[model samples]
Target: MNTEEKGLGSWTEREREELLELGHALFACPELGFQEVKSARILEDFFEKNGISFEKGLSVTGIKASIGKKGGYHIALVADMDALEVRDGENAYPFHSCGHSIQTAVMACVLKRLKERGIAEKTGGQVSFIAAPAEEFIDFETRAKLKEEGKIRYFSGKQDMISKGVFDDVDCVISMHINGDSGGPLFDINSTLAGFMVKKVIFRGKASHSGAAPHLGRNALHGASLAMDGIAYLKDQLPPEAGLKLHPVLTSCGGTVNVIPEQAVLETYIRANTLEYLLEAGEKFDRCVTHCGEALGIETEIINTTGYMPFAQSQEITEVVHRQMLELCREDQIVKNVVSGASGDIGDLGYLIPAVQFGFSGAEGRIHSAVFSVGDEENAYFRTARVAEKTVEAILSDPSLQVKNPDFQKKKEFYLREWLGENRE
Candidate 1:
């Protein structure tokens, strides 16, 4: 894995080996959201070995390390530190199917290079490396419990971090994700991500004997079916450019065949390309569910939880990244202006600060699947890190590349008031 063979002369052989090893270590011991103890330790040990100091215990397992002066133009290099749950046969285990391990490794490499070369000091600015947890947005039961214990207020790591004042002083953010090889480009820039909200509806009805007195009982499952039908019909009215998505699953319907079920539970996420459409679609969805339940003589209870916001990448920062990508690869190997239906917590961060999460290809299988694996170490780890390092340098050195700074308090107040509602507080 020499620099001459891969054209990654910026990194020494020892540094390259260390970065790859770090990625492998994180990949080997995968952990779920908000429970990433081992993953956090791996990153902490790496920072310590590199003589970089960091603060831990954020959102339970998140770590924040910074360099250079404070109260200046600050930029963040964000990495998500969690894995997806993959089921094999009857068993399920945590796996790095989304290439988050690669993200953490690349950000760590960038931070190390910046510190070793004193780039931040020379530019008279600050750069923060944030190893954020719980980007997967799973394990709701655990998160609910954590909320009850006052350990966390938001389910997503970045959301909780924002609430805890982690991004208060940050001016902009730079993040990356690993994409499966499409036989097209090695890098993707200026991609748009969907915002989403979680909905849990419970339909309540009367129970009765199925064979003897079926007519006397109200059918909750029937009510849920009608609501689903209404949603399906409403889908036609939604705008295509909104990129809305609704996938509902019945978590509980009935117990036995002979008994009329007294309750039915349906949960899903409402996703859209922007916050305006997201809220509008959510109101329509709630009306559909409630009206369907009313028509069926069943009582419906809806609980809404705030999910990640939609991501509109900062063109300012994205242009810098694009230039960096071109320096490493041909124009054909770089993709721009991609719109994806995927959702991530980085969207929440982007609401307050200008953020860009570019995608890189070096994996062999579909992300979030059991078969996903690292196919090329050079493209995945070395080249990705080089681009990030160069982008940070460019942004820090050029003061004119600054992003608009929104009032943190006002933005957060609106986010909590409109999206999270009064119940979260």
Candidate 2:
């Protein structure tokens, strides 16, 4: 493919080699969310080596670097740096099963190339490279502790970043994920994802010896099981268009099989295509679980945490990205209107700014699975950076590129109040 016509742009051989090397290094030493000490340091080292000034330790393990002199509009390229915790058989460790390593490597390369080519200066716009943390929403106990210590406010990385005003000056945002489906395009554009609310239910009861004093014990395990059943019965009540999803995992059932359980916990997420339906479903779930606990005469404590919102890419910005994507791949290699059942923190950012997220197909297994692996390094690492570079160029090239969602602040207010239960200042 002709470099200019394909929008691939030209990168030095050294640049390509460095990107793959970084990718391999990141993949080799995967770290979990909010605890990516080594991963953040590695990216910080890369920035320092490239003469790129950056701010480290935002949201504990997040980093931000700026490219191009301050001038016109500001665009941001966000890359989540945390890995997922996946367990298989007898082995379990933090792994890049979600392709975040590839995303981080590509984002770093994009900033490097933009600086090398003077693209940002020529286009007269500034670009921010944000390495965000805790996108996977795992390691809840640790995150809760961080919140208690006042080190972090939100569970998701982007939400915490927003709360800290990290994105106050950013006019537009772009990011990407991995699509493992072989039938899908090499690049999926303007795809939408569901929004969700996090739920943690703890059932408290008195413990007693199973065989000696069973009547004296109020079994929390029984209460949790009954709650799960109540939630399951709501499947038919949920509207089909709502795309409601309820998945619960029993984290703790009992201390031992012979003891009457004193406490049990259930962690779950209530997801829906629309925020209205999501909130409604979440309320019903809370009610259902509370009633289940009351029926069993056990005390239930419900902890509701804010989650991501539905993702809607800006039409104008999406058009710019779609045209550039067409230039980079064949017509058949571009997929539109892609909607997935999964959720992401990017959706939270999308509600506040003009944002667009795309995907590159270089993953071989289902997301969050042990078999997930990077299938094509060229496509995943190098080509993705190329597309990102072109997208930034497109945004910067137009000086009159005024982009904003009219409903952004309205949704932001609601998100703060409803999901976060925070009064607006």
Candidate 3:
């Protein structure tokens, strides 16, 4: 057996089998954000089996669990519990096609070996594995309703957790995404992700019968069309470094074709790498909407969301992890720095503490597609777990690994102050 399968001879067959079963079980049960009944229960059961202790439901189905007596280094590991929302012939919601099932299972497996190695006892630090909800950011209407009912202040689980002070005491945090199985080039360094602005563009005018009174009505739909055209023009002006994207989807308009639609709602995701640049692009967007509304005599309300801070990995922590990766390197691989066009909550966490997203791909196929399957389940569950274990071991065993990354701290402090708009209270 490989070192990963054996867990350095620490993990047992029974434990590995249990972990594998948990993976498939999660795949079978798909839950949406803030409504993860089955997912939460399965995770809780895993903790119970492993003798890990945790507090339940900080903010709707989010479980905060910890192992080891060491609170000194107190690092947190995160795994999103919610599944993707693409219809898989279900009577209700979508499926776990994104493979969060693998992500959670792999983390659980790592936790097992960490226990066997006495990592918690030796490192004098604890790893809090959190099954955070709402990472997928699904169902805007339901999220809006929850916001109104005061059940959640924000749509995202991580943001809500941050608001509740879940991360106030944590030092560093990490999470793994199952990017299908592939060979090298799985992980990236200082991976910059897309920052998004969720906005609702409502164009309002007047409605009248289209047959005889076509000129009597001022059409909101026409104004929306103009706004989309303006947004499309941004591609040329956008900075290449911005990681920019403008996707405007028309959500609601007048129902009938005979009447001019008085009110139209367009959902737009305005994204970029740097906030300054994104803010600039946002100004351009606002101007375009403003022009469209004014020209069409339509009133538009632009509501921009509390967009997530960018995911900028700590170079210091990344450097340490890379060095450790080199020591653990196989002949087929080398640690690398890669750029990502995707935006995630991981960047939001970096605003509070240093963060890094190390990726692993065993095999490749269409991810998030209807026909998607794990590229190499055998290697992913076991080998990836070992990679996590080895990294955690280095962090605990090497005092140098515990050495602070000054650059990471500096950037982290900067963003935290910027995001919080003041000192953290």
Total clashing pairs for each candidate = 0, 0, 6
Candidate-wise lDDT, in order: 0.89, 0.85, 0.73
Scored by lDDT, model 3 comes in at 0.73
Candidate 1 clashing pairs, residues 3+ apart or interchain? none
- TM-score for candidate 2, residues paired by index: 0.85
How does candidate 3 fare on TM-score? 0.84
Which lDDT tens digits does candidate 2 get at residues 1-425?
56655334687778788988998888887898888899898899999999988999999999999988775678889999999888999889999999898888889889888888888788778888999999997788999899999999888898988878888778889888887554456888888889988899999988999999989999999999999999999877788988889989999876787789999999998889877788789889989999999998999999877788988777888887777777667878887887788889898888889888888887778878998887766667766788888888877887656585567567677767766677632
Ranking by TM-score: 1, 2, 3
How many Å off is the CA of 11 in candidate 2? 2.1
RMSD for each of the candidates: 2.2, 3.6, 4.0
On the 0 to 100 scale, the lDDT of residue 34 in model 2 is 88
lDDT pick, better of 2 and 3: 2
Highest TM-score model number:
1
Residue pairs clashing, model 2: none
Report model 1's TM-score to 2 decimal places.
0.93
Model 3 C-alpha lDDT per residue in residues 239-287, reported as the tens digit of each score: 7887788889999996598988898989888888877767777788989
When 1 and 3 are scored with lDDT, the better candidate is 1
TM-score of each: 0.93, 0.85, 0.84
